[model samples]
Target: MTQDKLIRRVLKPVVWVLCLGPLGGLAWLAYSGGLTANPIEFLNRYLGEWALKFVIFALAITPLRGLTGWAGLTRFRRLLGLFAFFYVVLHLSSYVGLDQYFDWNAIWLDITKRTYITVGMVAAVILLALAVTSTKGMIKRIGGKNWNRLHKLVYLAAAAGCLHFFMMRKGVQLEPLMYGGAVLLLLGYRLVGYLKKRRRKSRLAVA
Candidate 1:
């Protein structure tokens, strides 16, 4: 089979199932009474952690593609991004519906009072914008250049997410630091690429 068919017909389905595996595990845990004493908190944290992980995975795709010369890797980026957003929605929903019980007042207070929640909300908003404009129709309507510019905010969202995770945790934790380091490395890679491109263009112009 052709590469495209392999990706579309076989790999995509496998990846899709793999993406849902976490949620399925969560469901099983819930049913089996394994979510710990604070189930709501556990659910929120678990979903939020997975969301951030998917976001990092999506961000890594471009760099990975460039390094490996596997352009087909781009095909899965959107799917991973959407799953990141999906888990983010579930994380937020758990906080709002299950934890807060739709208490808008308490929610607003938590958002205002808790720095981590505020940062997380900002990240969520950025992800929401990216998800909304992820469609082909939206891309055409916004123009390719504009859409690309808007999507660059994914880096900001990722950074904010890392910060949110860091601040949400008590004391100095290793997990958040590791996540933050990964984001920094990814951002560094992009910055180096941009600088090299600019230098190459300048040399061509001079020549």
Candidate 2:
């Protein structure tokens, strides 16, 4: 089979299983009395982490594909991005349902007044937009050029997610720092590629 077919048929299914395994594990943990003392916080924080992880994974696709010369990797990007959005929704639900018990006024206060929550909400909103327009129908409706432009918002969403995670911490922690650094590296890679493309375009114009 061709590489692209292999990626689509074999690797994509494997990736799907791995990506969703965490949610299944969480359910098992909850059922088995393994969610620790603060189950709500555990689930909220855990789901948020997985969502950020998928975001980073989606962002890493370009650099990884460039380095490995595997164009087929791009096919998996939409799936990864959608999973990120899925987890974000779950994270929000956990926070509202379990943590706040659907307290709209308090939730509004937290979203508006709390720095970490506010930034996290901003990131969630950006992800929601990307998720809503992730379909082929939406792409056709928006036009490919416009869709590409709108999807670039993922970079800002990632940055905001990192900042939210960092600010949510009680003190200095290495985990958030590492996530921030990874995001910076991915963004730096994109910047370098953009500059190279611009330079190539300029050289072609001169020629």
Candidate 3:
């Protein structure tokens, strides 16, 4: 098989394995006394980190394709985005189910009253909506133009997610700061590209 086909063939399974394998490994660590104390916090941290990582993955697609000219990466964006949703769900579940004991009212109060939680919840909702409508059937049903418009919301979702992470912590941490920086740089690349295109168009019009 050609290199491209080989890469494509292995991509899905590899991503799935890498994503879930860690969760299983962590669970095993907890069961075997590695995370004996405060396993719930460990689980929450893992899920939260994955959610932000997935957001970064989703955001990286356009920049990656733009920089490397590997258009095929666009095909994986949906899967990456859905994985972000999965992690966010897991993160929230860990809090609600494991932490809060399924207290609906308390959860509701936390969501509404807590600024960081509210931002994160809103971002998650937007990601979930985008993921649900990501399929071709939904695209056809919604119409391509409308779908495109809706998908643009991913940028806002990503920004909100980053900010949510930034605010959730009491003090600045290097790791999350790095994630935010990467998001900013990736987005900056797109902005610069747009300006370049605009400048070229203006120069042509003057000529």
How does model 2 fare in lDDT?
A: 0.96
Task: Report the Cα lDDT for residue 71, model 3.
Answer: 81
Clashing pairs in 3: none
Q: Rank the candidates by lDDT, best first.
A: 1, 2, 3
- TM-scores vs. true structure, each candidate: 0.97, 0.95, 0.90
> Which residue runs of candidate 1 sit more than 4 Å off their true CA positions?
none
Give candidate 3's root-mean-square deviation (CA, Å): 2.0
Output the number of the TM-score-best candidate.
Answer: 1
For candidate 1, lDDT tens digit of each residue in 48-94? 99999999999999999999999999999999999999999999999
CA lDDT, candidate 2, residue 138: 99
Q: Which digits, one per residue and each the tens of the lDDT, describe model 2 over residues 39-82?
A: 98999999999999999999999999999997888999999999
Rank candidates by TM-score, best first: 1, 2, 3
CA-RMSD of model 2? 1.4
Give the clashing residue pairs of candidate 1, or none. none
As for TM-score, the candidate ahead, 1 or 3, is 1
